[model samples]
Structure formats: structure tokens, C-alpha cells
Target: MPTEYSLPDTLDRIYTNQLALEAAIMELTLLIEQQGHTEVGENVRGALYAIGENAGHIKQGIAKLVLQHRGD
Candidate 1:
């Protein structure tokens, strides 16, 4: 038998991951502020920002998928 998947459960997992990513971004920002503009800090900050942006996009896509699935 094929494994069953639940849309709502998957959505919840995505949402939780998004929240954790946002929190990590916030913490990283604070650390950067405290550490000042060192080369390594700037590089790390940029990478974290990119990750946060991707996570946001992922969350939005998941939301759209949920909406479309429900409309069916």
C-alpha cells in the first residue's frame, strides 16, 4: 500500500519551519548588531538573510497550495 499524506500536517510543518527560520534570522541580526561590521559577520548576515527570504517564499507557496487544494 502507498503511504498516505495529510495536507494539513504538511502545511503545519512548513509553517513551523518558517517560524523557526524567522527566529534564527532575528537572532542573527542581533548578533551582527552587537559584533559590528566585520567581514565574516557581514558575510554570515547576508547568507542568513537569503535563507530567510527563501523561507518566506516557501511559506507563501505552501499557503497557495493549501488554498488551491481546499478549493477543489
Candidate 2:
């Protein structure tokens, strides 16, 4: 099979999707809190915290991969 997308390109797309999902989930959490679901919102917030941290790491890793590819 012919190669379609490179590793860096695929990882970047994944990162983009991750960010979009994170934003959508955050919006939902806000709406949930507004509906008096503080406990649920809090739980979601905790999960979001972990997601946010991993996102930063993923972003950095992708950047490094792109930079390395450019040096090739």
C-alpha cells in the first residue's frame, strides 16, 4: 500500500481533534454546572485537568517531531 500521510501529519491531526473535543467537553461542563450539577461538573473538571496536562505534553511532542522531520 502507498503511504498516505506522514507520522507528523497524522499526529498533528490527532492533536487538533483532541483540542476540539476538549473545548466541546468544557462547554458541556459549564452548561452542566449551570443546571445545578456542581458535583458532576467538578468531576469533569478534574478529568479536564488531566486532559489539559496531557495536551501540553502531546503538543510539545508533536512540535519536536515536526522539527525533527524538517531537519531530515
Candidate 3:
């Protein structure tokens, strides 16, 4: 009876969106750097570093959530 609105599904969707946005931001940051705005790009990259750090933990947590629900 589990629908798409279930906990694991919701989290997975959110994670997917997170990854997509990260990619988009990276592309934009690269473009900014190419345009000679190195300082702006560096600041954006600094924030991206933090986001990348947490992304690993978020992915692992989502995997654990899905695994735990497999037995349900």
C-alpha cells in the first residue's frame, strides 16, 4: 500500500533535485570563472564545498532509509 508519497520516495526525490541543482550551479560557476570573475567564482566554490561535504552524508542516509524499509 505504499504510494509515491512515502518517506523513502519523498527523500529520494528531494535528493535527486539536490543533485540536479548542484550540477546546474557548478555549470554556472564554471561560466562565471570563464568570464574573468574569479573572485565571485571562488566564493561560490567555497559554498559549494560545504554543500558537497553534506551531500555524501545525505546520500548515505537516504540509502539506509531505503534499505531499512525494504523489510517492511
Candidate 4:
């Protein structure tokens, strides 16, 4: 059977995935730097920053939801 998830659950999953992606991006960035690809490393780091920003947004949203639904 298919599984079901609530809003918070979904958001948590998204946040987790974002973190994983961020880690992977960092690792890839390091590898690029090790290869002396400064330009490519910079580009990858830029993307990593964006992903981190989005993850922060997701975390904030999750906190807001928790506060909004505190009584529940």
C-alpha cells in the first residue's frame, strides 16, 4: 500500500533531502578544487550556497508550522 504523510512530515523529508544534497555538493566542490578547477569549484560553491539558503528557508517554514499548530 501507498504511504501517507502530513504537512510537517513532508517538510521534514524535504529538509532532510536538502541537507543531503548540500553535503554531496560540498564533497563535489572539494573534489573539483583538488583537481585545480578553480572556476568550476566556484560555480559549484555558488550552487551549494543557494541550496543552503533554500534549506534554511525550509527549516524556518517548518518552525512556523510547528508554532502555528502548537495546540494540535
TM-scores vs. true structure, each candidate: 0.54, 0.87, 0.86, 0.78
List RMSD in Å for every model shown.
4.2, 2.2, 1.4, 3.1
Model 4 quality (TM-score): 0.78
After superposition of all CA atoms, the RMSD between model 3 and the true structure is 1.4
Ranking by TM-score: 2, 3, 4, 1
Which model is ahead, 1 or 3, in terms of lDDT? 3
For each candidate, the alpha-carbon lDDT, in order, equals: 0.70, 0.89, 0.90, 0.80
> Cα lDDT of model 3 overall?
0.90
After superposition, the stretches of candidate 3 with alpha carbons farther than 4 Å from their true spots are none
Tens-digit lDDT track for model 3 on 1-72? Answer: 575887888998998998898889999999999999999999989988898999989989988988888877
Q: lDDT by residue for model 1 over 3-61, one digit each (tens)? A: 12557557768678867876887677678778775666677677877877777677778
Give a tens-digit lDDT track for model 4, residues 1-72. Answer: 122376766778878887887898889889989999999999988888888777767788898886765546
TM-score of 2: 0.87
Comparing 1 and 4 on lDDT, the stronger one: 4
TM-score of 3: 0.86
Count of backbone collisions within predicted model 4: 0
- Please write out the lDDT profile of model 2 over residues 1-72, one tens digit for every residue: 222386888899988998899899999999999999999999999998999989989989989998997787
Specify the poorest-scoring 10-residue window by lDDT in model 3: 1-10
Off by over 4 Å in 1: 1-5, 25-29, 32-37
